[model samples]
Target: MIRSAYSLQAAEAEIPALSATPLDVVALLAQAHHPEAGAVVLFSGEVRNHNQGQDVDYLEYEAHEAMAEKMIAEIINDAHAKWPLKIAVAQHRTGKVAIGETAVIVITSSAHRHEAYEANQYIIHRIKHEATIWKCEYFTDGSKKWGGNCSCCPPAL
Candidate 1:
């Protein structure tokens, strides 16, 4: 929770239930210009029960916290460099998570909607594909599967 000229926001937490990533709060922070910034964009990525047609009982997510945070910081930096972003925030859940829980949220604010949207998308995409995080899947059959690179379970691409 380090505050900066443009807050550096990111977290790796255990998600057990519903999480609120309200646009207004994040937007207000990003749109420090508030009344002057008229547009905001927010994206929430939830943890769904099914993946590749398998019935997911729950998911266990693990990450190299230090590295993951560093990666998120870079993504935010890139978003700012690539867009007219006023504020940026991204969060991801770690540890056990149930179905329908939110795993990630990205919020970006700009003077315009277009820039906000682009920055939001960029942050989410990087978090999903580039973060140093891994997921384990528990299925209805009492079996489990791990992310592609996980050594303790089957490969999941």
Candidate 2:
């Protein structure tokens, strides 16, 4: 098996866990700042007003909290294995989220722009596709769909 390019253990993150409260993007970004890191990247996954042909009113998320957090931490570790990072963090919200609200955020910092960008992308993608989190969309049309598992962004207007 191929090992990490940098063998340093990933620092235990206080982020990368499920949140019942709003995700604090600014605070997480601040925490990701590091003197050694020349580039910091952040991806915010927000709740949108629509999806597919439905006019969405709001969203509700649920998760097996412990399992989701453990998976996210492992994703962060995988990102560390691929890139030499100064900081890496991710968090997702559970319960109700209104339109224009942020549901998830991932932050990464590295010595170069490329590493930070790629690692941040990797973390968010893995979290969306692999985490135990689930989303339910409530449409203004009075219908609801129970699975859009990813915290997807609003499509262009």
Candidate 3:
């Protein structure tokens, strides 16, 4: 099956853990499906309690969202440019999120499992590596720090 859909949102809400519901993602994939597609692949990035040995209490995300969405749209365009994708959608949450909550979701569909798998990976990698965004880590000790902006963080692609 070959379908067409894309979505992105940044919200302040309680993030789900363990078994989270990505309604937007589900809906997008449902739209993306085509009778010819045999597989769908989805990638979700969740909040974890530890980073670089630091105990994270929570996370605060900030974005120039209008531009961020534009860039995200570009990633989707690039993925489709590079792969045989039937459908693709990417959504990310912003604001305060606790440990073990979903932060991002990338879903891709294709005629075969391999295309879906590769497209999903490409979406996530681009989101992390190229997306114009920043995050701050809040620790149990009341310390806060920025990530993705510091040279200590991984280099941008």
RMSD of each: 7.5, 6.1, 6.6
Error of 3 at 47 (Å): 0.3
lDDT of 2 by residue, 49-106 (tens): 9898789999999999999989998988888888998778888999999999899998
Runs of candidate 3 with Cα error greater than 4 angstroms are: 1-32, 148-157
- Residues 41-155, candidate 1: write the lDDT tens digits: 7677666777777888987788888888878878888888998776777777788877877677777767889888877877877777788877788888898998843223322
Best by lDDT: 2
Better of 2 and 3 by lDDT: 2
Candidate 2 TM-score, true structure as reference: 0.86
Comparing 1 with 3 on TM-score, the higher-scoring candidate is: 3
Which residues of candidate 2, in runs, are more than 4 Å off? 1-12, 149-157
Number of the predicted model whose TM-score against the real structure is largest? 2
Ranking by TM-score: 2, 3, 1
Model 1 regions more than 4 Å off: 1-33, 148-157
lDDT of 3: 0.67
Give the distance in Å from residue 44's predicted Cα in candidate 3 to where it truly belongs.
0.8
Q: Per-residue lDDT for 116 in model 3?
A: 88
> Per-residue alpha-carbon lDDT of model 3 for 1-157, expressed as tens digits?
1122222221111222112233354554455555556887877677778777778998877777777777788888788788877667777767787788767887777888988898887777777666766788998888898884333334322
